[model samples]
Target: MKRLNIGLKEVQGVYDGPEGKLWELIMGEQIHIGGFMESMVMAKKAGIKEGQKVLDLCSALGGGLRFLVKNFKVQGFGLDGTKTMFDEAKKRAQAEKVADKIEFKLGNVLDIPWSEGTFDVVWGEDAWCYVTDKDKLVQGAAKVLKKGGTLAFSDWIEGPAGLTEAEAERVNKFMKFPYMESGKGYEAIIKKHGLTLKSSEDLGPHFASCIDLYIRMLSEQLTFDALRIIGDNMEMFKGMGGEMAFMADLARKGKFSRGRFIAVK
Candidate 1:
């Protein structure tokens, strides 16, 4: 999480390395907060059920889609920004035997390759925070959903009062987020997209706990493995620990937040 001179390209390089694998190890296959617990909560709140269609925008490795398909009997497609991620996701689908239930594609989230009104749901995880054009992403999701479908996602966001500019810059550079919105801020965007808001709540407390847990896992239990993952770069590891600690404190204080939203199309 250190803001290493690693810009976007170099950041991508890290993901192609042990850093990305470390994230998967701590966060499970659902590399966002709360894993399947979080996914189940959102699916239930959105009234997702068997036979519904879904389009998972920015769906890394098809984990969330597989979770829904296996649990709710829904079928879906996952769209991600990277083919490397999709390639791994495809393998996961086949290995998990969800290959028949989900498909993975590589494309831009802001400009999906699918036709309009193609899905019953448009879903994302924490990945959307990476997009700079948040409105365009929202519009694309809205455009792709059927009239009676749902739009559901959970994202890393700013809290109700928002982040200080300096804090925002530091967090963005470390987390690779272009910008983050608050629960209130994202609700306004959903309304603008003409989706009926079912629920828009700050899930910051849950994420705070998750971050704290990961810190504990790395610092307390998995130190050796984690050290190997980063090639034993003690300075980088220390920087990441400090950055994560800052994020955890912000989440606990309601400055950095996670926003969960469900909307009717």
Candidate 2:
């Protein structure tokens, strides 16, 4: 398999662009997964509670951390590998007035900074697709989670039949997914780490609808901004658009999906 080369740096840079903010504008407080309430519902179901320590793995700009601290009343520690995103996340946490309750650390997902069984819950948003080693990432989460702790995350997963190498390369290159896994592949990894699978669900509509609406939103509303950014590089924008369209087509065909995994240690 080829590496997607997507990371905190690439994601942060893209998010810094007009398209990035557009996504936030469209996604609103939910980020990219349709709605914040859905994520919160999952968090609540995972037994996240007041004052419990939580780890927001692969946290970018502290979105998930902020939600955990504010809605769930949990103290948060966010970890990300990109220095730029780490700084931005720190600023965001402070801006949200939750910096006191949350700590942003610059680190990789494969290597968590805390000790074994350090947190009550290890939560991730729709961000783990960037990590290369799925098993190691799962094991690391399990290692840092306390006994009875929960490992809850929603990620872009390979659909039931999974992705072919060529298709994987296409999707990964465009979406910045380093690797994607089947739902059962993820289940097996979590089970291998001794975590019990509490629930698993396909979150396809969110992805499919969002991608569809995003393209429409751009075509109808963001044409001016996109032209400004893509000035002199219209071809680059066109190429990316083709890739995005391909992704949307795949989602429509039920060839790719986003899966929400809630597991207990």
Candidate 2 per-residue lDDT over residues 1-265, each given as its tens digit: 5567666566656555654554455566445475677677778778788999999887776887888888878999988886656787889888889999998888778888899989999988877887778899999999999999999988887776556789888888777667787788899999999999999888776778878887886668766666675564678767766877888877776678888888988
Candidate 1 per-residue C-alpha lDDT over 116-212 given as tens digits, one digit per residue, 9 for 90 to 100: 9989889888877777677888998999899988999999988875788888889988887767777887898999999999998888788899899
Query: Can you give the TM-score per candidate against the true fold?
Result: 0.94, 0.89
- Which stretches of model 2 miss by more than 4 angstroms? 1-30, 229-232
Clashes of each: 0, 0
Lowest summed lDDT across 10 adjacent residues in model 2 is found at 21-30
* Overall lDDT per candidate, in order of appearance: 0.84, 0.79
Model 1 scores a TM of: 0.94
